[model samples]
Target: MKKLLQIIIGLGFILTPFYTNAHVKWFTEVAPKKESIENILSPLFMGLALLAAVVLASLTIIIPKMAQMPLIKKWDDYLSGFRKYSRYLLKYGTAVALIIQVTNGTLFAPEFQLDSTLLTVLAWVTIGLLLVPHHIATKLGASILLILFIMVTVKHGIFYMLDYGFYVAIIGVLLVGSTKLENVGFPFLYLGTGLSLCWVAVEKWVYPTMSLDIVANHQVPTFGFEPAAFIVMAAFVEFVVGYLLVVGILNRVLGFVVTTIFILTTMLFGFTEIIGHFMIHIVLIIFIIEGVSFYNPPIKMHKTRVDQFIFIFLNFIFVLSTFVLIYYRFA
Candidate 1:
């Protein structure tokens, strides 16, 4: 009973709305009168819901165990069944940490005024978590993460969906790779992830500053500056980083720098461009994990048909979008 309650509490932490209250606050502050109530009460309701769940879970653990019921004994058995696999835990945990660090630092850190140095520290922290063995606590971590990610992506739309897709793919790869499938079709996975980043980079070139100032202004800013310079720089960064990422070169360094830039943009201007920074932060984390230096994955399987299909799809979207952004910016 106690174990089950603990798991329930852990899950609550993941799904609770208060976790993203900052975003809600920003939205409510900017929303018109009609939507103000949603902005105000949504997070509050969520917080209360989670609090209730936590309290209930605590009672389940404390009351039943003290009473020594058969139900509690049965619950403990079920809890014991969900044991953590240490090696798998380390590999996967490190992978997640890397992704989160990059997302927060590079893609979204700037919005928060965080330093790039903090990214490095976070990277290490994530890596350290992997070194430790998985406990029921780790399982709890994974479960909450999975649930929160699912909910956030669903609420956010295609951009969020794609973000979740990539994350899921990475998690699947890590979980599968930790087993005998270590030498399996890994390059394709990295390639897919890299292509996505590269595409975004290409768009950046045409909108150096990502027209971030306009985002800060909460409306598109007047485009009086020479957009050409920014566009060129963005393109160069995107192409170089994209190509290198796929080829497996200087991943950690690149990830650090990329995430740093993202953080800068968001902290500096993301409030006005809420969705932009939100999506960017999510991608930055994925990129960082893909770029981490600690683990050396041996190549076994080449790109399969499904992998090729995704590659083509992403390539088309990125290339088409890049040209469109460029044309629009110049026009």
Candidate 2:
């Protein structure tokens, strides 16, 4: 009954603003012709959002049960071996990158439509340096490259480089055989994700205009509710979710749920449509890593009723936000 009540409340939150439809203008995007709503919101985005909600809801319900199942526990043992394999793959990956660098420069030129620029050349050079007979020089070269890469990532806007920088850094770690460092990376990983998510929610809130416009012009509605209300709701939900994510509260479940939404987002927005599907794959990798963490659970994280309440509350908020956005756009 408690869970049912929570779901009901969440549905209500999602559905109420949907009836108002006062903020369709928020979703519009400026285009070459003019501000076309169609240009702002695509079917892919909408479908992805809906699909994410569904998948998250399912996972939230199922994963716990799976955790309890004897078969699932056995399966996790086999899955654990992948981490060791991942370490081996990382070493070989440098070789692959080396091959690609050579091929890209020699065979696939500008004529071949591959980017064979200075950075590509440098990347290959570093890879070769890592392969030398001298372990000290190899490790030193790789470490320097890793440091340079991190410096570049931090110096630039976190949002601009975060996605790609994260992938590169992860690859570097794997290549260098830093499994021990995974312990150190865990807290920072949580901190970074939490901060990013919180910031995203805040950005949408502050610039409700951009996010809301995307909703309106794209023809995604808020269950017939006024646009302003929906925008407010969205801002609030994102803020709350972001806060929770950053603080590392309810991280496991939230991580799973958020990943689902991100996956849907990639499918709808076009991995290549936004920044390229590469980031999407990176996100998937992050999700997998998180799943592995949960399975092995190097650290023990205890849950409280407060955590459950927050999860249910946030879920409710998104449900209402979605329903409202849809109702206004359609009905």
Candidate 3:
């Protein structure tokens, strides 16, 4: 047990820097460039990808066993105690994200700048509604957020706006609050946020040039790997994180590690990093609080150990390939 803990912690420390710097698009201006499918399917890429799949599959078996351990069970239960407050965290964290966006003259993301007075005022109004204590007020705020999202989609095109799809999930959570279906809100949040991260990770593979540019310009450390290879590893790390979130595996531990990584990156990326990732930070906190106690993840359906391992391994490969192909096709 002690050795296993040390290994996990060591891997986390090594991967932390890569995860922190993976949001290249947010920090750089390079346009997406299409790489040849052959280049993307290179031996090194496939090898690392297969290795990642095996590791994830192994974890699907290991994590459940780990959860039964006394210390881990206690920690999970302690975190679960805070689940009741998730709604408030989502509500005010969203309000804070809106305030940051409106004050900066942007919409949901830093790249989508507000271009008109009416839109700016509506953004503020949405923030005001979100701040109100009533459920109706929060729902109205979510409605306005949906409108703002649509407006930005109309201006920027759906492909560009898809990176911020988690906003729609946030809107869903707000609208469904205090209802019989409120239970579904957190699951949807996890799914939406997970898919968004996976989508962004695909961008790194599709447009390696952009990430390469960010690393070169920002002098991001590569830890002895060449910049291009480092980008590939980073993208894989991010994709695996998203996959874990979607599968509801290691919710609290994953949340704490990822949130810490994002916070550490602020030192390098500074204010822009915070503005771009504030909502994600909030979502991770909710993940820590919720900890998959109230929900049955897809992994729970497998019943047998071998079936569970196969399910995780195949699904990781399938999701990674599907995301890469779809993103590359659309790009």
Candidate 4:
């Protein structure tokens, strides 16, 4: 019962008020209805499902037990050592994110492309200030970020931009939070990134044909499942991992898993995956190093194996429920 309550500790629905008939109509108009669920879930999908089950079990069971082994303890200690450089790592990472936004011609989204040279120049200027050491620069950076946020929110609409706008908001949090709270920034970044991933995951569910098409063209291995089922399972994994990231539960282990997945994807897809996910690679490296920041620790972390298992399982359910509610309401 205590653990169930703990699941909701930091879980808050950030309602996007931009839910209107127009947006609903837009999504429904474009959503693909050709795929069948049973057709997608084949022998391969079951195999992948079994692997996912093992991973879930390992997180709650084997991982906690492995932590007691000497080899794993040394690894934990080594990772803990990187916490000292977390701030510097995050600051520079912000710069790379901004550069990627410009280079990609999109703020990480194809729809929200910044077309104007003037706005691009301004964004780069603010990005430059972020790298500078002057204390006043932080406030100036925050001002520019606020201006950009308003521009995006006004031009793109909150609902439209909410999918990837969180990245921009993360930059704002760092600049504003540095000058004031000195702490609010990273937590917001962590949350924003998680939400961004989950939001993108929903796209697969909404437009399964697009992903299935990609799968067909690429001949991507489905671990024995049909293309549609693999795509759906991929969405679930992305959403669940994103949820785990926000709640700060077994995040380091998940970080490794996601990183490995991305690397393997690069091997399979070749250069396109590399170019598309470059900034994400940077973010994953940061999470891999930092684990979860201690800045937003409301849930009392448990040490015992049983307590850890309950905590992880509940967080998974929390994210799963959130995803279902959001999908039904928005998608």
Residues 113-170, candidate 2, lDDT per residue (tens digit)? 2243655555666667656645454556556556545554555544434323334544
Q: Report the C-alpha displacement of residue 4, candidate 2, in angstroms.
A: 40
Off by over 4 Å in 4: 1-62, 165-169, 176-180, 267-276, 293-315
lDDT rank order: 3, 4, 2, 1
lDDT of 4: 0.58
lDDT of residue 88 for candidate 4: 55
Which is superior by TM-score, 3 or 4? 3
The collision pairs in model 3 are none
Clashes of each: 18, 46, 0, 3
Candidate ordering by TM-score (highest first): 3, 4, 2, 1
Q: Model 3 reaches what TM-score against the true structure?
A: 0.92
Question: Which wins on lDDT, candidate 1 or candidate 3?
Answer: 3
What TM-score goes with each of the models?
Answer: 0.37, 0.47, 0.92, 0.72
What lDDT score is found at residue 151 in candidate 3? 91
lDDT of 3 by residue, 1-331 (tens): 5543543364335323222544677877888688999999888789998999899889877877778889988998776666666788789879988888778877777777888998999999999999999999999999998998899889888988778889989999999998999989989988888888999888888889989888888888889999989989988888888888888775677677876765576666666666677788777767877887766889999989898889988998999999989988885
How well does model 2 score by local distance difference test?
0.42
lDDT per residue (tens digit) for residues 124-152 in model 1: 45445444455443334334344444544
| Highest TM-score model number | 3
lDDT of 4 at 192: 78
Give Cα distance to truth, residue 318, candidate 1, Å.
Answer: 9.6
